[model samples]
Target: MEKPWTKSVTLALEGPGKYVTISNTTEASWAMIEDWPLDDAPALNRALDICAAAVEGKRPAEDARKAFIEAAVEADIEIRE
Candidate 1:
């Protein structure tokens, strides 16, 4: 099934590194904002890997969120002040 929001999301996250603006209108999706490193470092790779894994259904969304949150914290990126 094609998802409109997902298409929007692909466009939103199209760059190698960019700000993530998440907004969910469905039960399985939620909103978040993440600033990614433009250097294409390990952190960025990890973030993209996690997102791709989640989107491909290789991992659950909650799990992906947890991974991303952990990564963000490790990277010293403050979220949800």
Candidate 2:
């Protein structure tokens, strides 16, 4: 017997000032979103929204990636993953 393949989304926001990362990958890791600052609201919300749209199949992964990059650029935030 073999294990079935599965996918999942991992959202994590570390210490203050760190840009939240939304990693879409196989079910290999799990994380929780917590301790986010109020100032990071807009960008964080947008990221979550984009992730939601992508997971729901409302948008292609590439399109979502582009959107994420665009939003990050607009906010002057650097994406590391």
Q: Quick one: best TM-score, which candidate?
A: 1
TM-scores for all predictions: 0.46, 0.40
**Candidate 2 lDDT, 4-33, residue by residue in tens:** 223222223454355455544111112213
- Runs of candidate 1 with Cα error greater than 4 angstroms are 1-34, 38-43
User: What stretches of model 2 exceed 4 Å from their correct place?
Assistant: 1-22, 25-48, 79-81
RMSD to truth, every model: 8.3, 7.2
RMSD of 1: 8.3
CA lDDT of each candidate?
Answer: 0.44, 0.42
Cα RMSD of predicted structure 2: 7.2
